[model samples]
Target: MLMLRRTKNFLNAHGVEYEKEHVNPLMVPERVYVLKFGKRDGEFLNRFIVEHSYTWTGRDKINKITLRLHGQKHPREFANEAKLLQYLEKHADRYVKKQGNKKAGKNS
Candidate 1:
């Protein structure tokens, strides 16, 4: 919960738009943050989701932030908020919607 709050605060402070959603309502019940940045031909060019997870068995596990990027086979886990924020800031980009007729703008 604390990790998620901190992530949300970072996103808000950075002016990064994101969506909050549950990973699985019935089974997982974990909430995740989805963010889309940059665009190509009106399609999202970069996308990623952040999730928080922990375990309660044996020694108590510390909360970690998981970042899953599109087209990646595995997700990257981060324990430091600054590093995660730095990564997100580096990848985040402003999306400008293309103007005028799409097909006519292309070369013959």
Candidate 2:
């Protein structure tokens, strides 16, 4: 929970816009958040969604983070918060650039 809170704070402080949605609660109480970019003209801009699930009590207690990116069939799972943050920081700019180029191509 602490790691998730820190990640949310970091995104807020960096002025990043993201949408959070709750995944199936009956099965697993997981939260899925996606970083959004580009113009919305009724077209879906493919991006990555981060899904995390954690529990504090019981033997089933677990803290897990997974990232599902564009053009990738399999999701990349992170064992810890540091690695997840590092991955986000490294690829976020690239996605922004790609989105800009996509918009530019449409204008041309």
Candidate 3:
């Protein structure tokens, strides 16, 4: 896996906007089998929904989760994250508006 700094640099170079979600390195599973057997995938997916879904209001408009499984060959998790990102990117306008509405409601 690549170092976090390297990942950040790569994303920056590619013009990808991202937020880093700090996590406990020791708690992160290094293998796909462990993630699947330990039920981390389910938890991650749920967290992803909560973070990305524009159902909540406030300053937390975008919820970016940075995983430490950099070199891990977890194709499933990667695919899931990619799918979510694609969905968000495809309907970015709607999602942004939804987030705006959420903030407006909070302000009022």
Q: Please provide, for model 1 over 1-108, each residue's C-alpha lDDT reduced to its tens digit, 9 standing for 90 to 100.
A: 343556566656655455554453456634455555444455554444555444555332335566765466787877766777677667554323343456654567
Show where candidate 1 strays beyond 4 Å: 1-3, 9-16, 22-62, 94-108
The sequence of per-residue lDDT tens digits that candidate 3 reaches over residues 1-108 is 222344345335544444334233355333121111112323322122122313335222333433333234442233334544555456445312123234445557
lDDT of 3: 0.33
Which sections of candidate 2 miss by over 4 Å? 1-3, 27-62, 96-108
How far off is residue 30 in model 1, in Å? Answer: 8.7
The lDDT values for all models are: 0.54, 0.55, 0.33
lDDT of 2 by residue, 23-59 (tens): 4446657655554433245433444355555446432
The true-versus-predicted C-alpha distance at residue 56 of model 1, in Å, is 10
TM-score for each predicted model, relative to the true structure: 0.42, 0.51, 0.24
RMSD of 1: 8.1
Model 1 scores worst on lDDT over the 10 consecutive residues at 92-101
Residue 60 displacement (Å), model 1: 12
Evaluated with TM-score, which candidate comes out highest? 2
